[model samples]
Target chain A: MDTKIKTNNTTSEKIHSSENIDEQMLERLFRQFSQEIPDDGFTDRVMKSIAAVSQEESVSQKTAFSLKAQIPLLKSLNWFTAILSVAIFLFAGGPQLVWNSVFAPIFSNVTSILPVSVFRWTFDDWLVAFFRQAHQLYSIDVLTTPLPTIYILLAVLTALAARRLALLTV
Target chain B: MPSVTDIALVLQVVTIGSQRAFATLVERHQEPVRRFLRSLTNGDEALADDLAQETFIRAWQGLRSFRGSASFRTWVMRIAYHTFLDEVRKSKPTETLDSNQRIEPNATQTDNFMLRHDVQQALDSLSEIERTCITLQLIEGQSIADIATISGLPQNTVKSHLMRGKQHLTTYLRNHGYKD
Candidate 1:
């Protein structure tokens, strides 16, 4: 290694009597002085950073394929929207129907006997308005007439939420 | 085996995000890159090692751009050279505040307590390009053409830097009792 490092740069030289500027000698000294320090797990540390960075990249890639994210577009949501509407109505309307048929009469009788001046409890106006709006929404055919933009927004939001959930679990 | 065989293979594995294969590449190439950075930083082992880590990280990110136009070692050397330049430029202001900041690698105050006053005096005085060219040419035993490629200087420019750097180094050695 030392012998091969000798240079042939002889364009000029500064020699005084027995002394001379030597490129070959300079090359040798450079090699000798440049000591190689021992590597103490330098590679391991680098690999760890690489692992962390690559893991982040893979997570981003996985998020690209999230299930809920694939639910946009009315064409794709036709079946899902129908099923979702039915499930929503079942969960929301079930108690309402029971309340209207059974609880409303009982409540009315109880209130009639207990309230004249003190017990003045009627259904909250806001609650009634919310349920009324919910019923109107339930009556609309989701698959008919160019689907409301709110449904698309809801689907996108749900997809994004699903993606966030997937990332958290990871 | 050709050096590229190991580098190219491990590079493939790393592209698919395999840390193990990337570790192999790191292990194999760490010595030269670290050693190179060590000289560039004038034996500031900590800074050199940090820059070396940065070099490998950059290499890993830019692996796909390595089109095999040069050997992996040369490509890595190129990255390290640029990294060193960036570091030097970054550290230049602080270098003035402390005179001992830019000590020669072989300072008489450090390991080589007996090294005379003329130690790398000429090498120290050379321009950064000259210092880089000379270091790579001499210590690493790289060819002028390879140095040119690594430094992104023209071949002729590399030769000129090498010639001028050697002349000064020759004078520095002679004054320090280095006999031909």
Candidate 2:
């Protein structure tokens, strides 16, 4: 009821039913433009939309916060996958290729300080078995070379898939 | 009396995401903003209300930037004015001359329907600037300075637009047998 069209209502009231039309009538008619054009629930509609927007804002914000909370775990998983791939490649006869240039001193120190038994039944043992299996496969002329690059490629592809899956779901 | 302080208090509440305060502002100001847009839209109520809704949404987004240099109503009206201008500008490049700019000779009805339709036709006949100036001045009862503030035109230019717009409407009404 806020936007009552004061123009048509008030105009006929203020102007006598005289046949003569003056500039005053014109002014009055124009003044009708200023009259409230009765909203008929327009405000309610606007307020409803406002409330909907506020609700949507809160909901989306909560969703975003939840998404942010998932990020650290996703990142850790990504790092784990990347590290596992690197570790597998390193132990699978790829270390000799990098032994002198990269891993010689670090390997020597690690072997000296760590007992051989400590590496059993863990990822280290898995790495050694994986290399042994790969070496046997290569020795039979299945691969004329020690192909640690394949395991490295697999590791990278695994990390990439994990990264993509994380992104897609979240 | 909706005092300035009360309005300012509501505005402050709105800044903190108070829906009630924002609704209060909308209830208080929606009439004038919608009417102003109605005039701009040539009585296209739906278009006018859409613009009004957009104006309010923009106001809500940018409420924090309101420096209170103008009355809150004036501030909203100014946004309404620019919103109309922006809509017009965006559509201008694609607009063809309204194919039927001339009125039908058969505008002979004396009922409220015809009067309202005739008024809409008269409003649509004016140039956009003239219609804007006349609407702000005559319909909305705003002073020339306030019209300048809302429409972002110089006071003298606003006056000239008002004069020319009124003259055109006078002629249009006279020809239509709407009391001279």
Candidate 2 lDDT, B45-121, residue by residue in tens: 67779989989888877888878777788889999999988887777523422413322335665455566666767
Position B118, candidate 2: lDDT: 67
Best-fitting candidate, scored by DockQ: 1
Worst 10 residues of 2 chain B by lDDT: B93-102
lDDT of each: 0.67, 0.71
- lDDT of predicted model 1: 0.67
lDDT over C-alpha atoms for residue B65 of model 1:
82
User: Which residue ranges in model 2 land beyond 4 Å of their true spot?
Assistant: A1-23, A32-35, A55-170, B3-6, B92-110
Whose lDDT is greatest here? Answer: 2
lDDT of 2: 0.71
lDDT of 2 by residue, A65-151 (tens): 887889866766666766686557655656455555465556556767785643324443455566668668775332343446545
Scanning candidate 1 chain B in windows of ten residues, the lowest lDDT window is B111-120
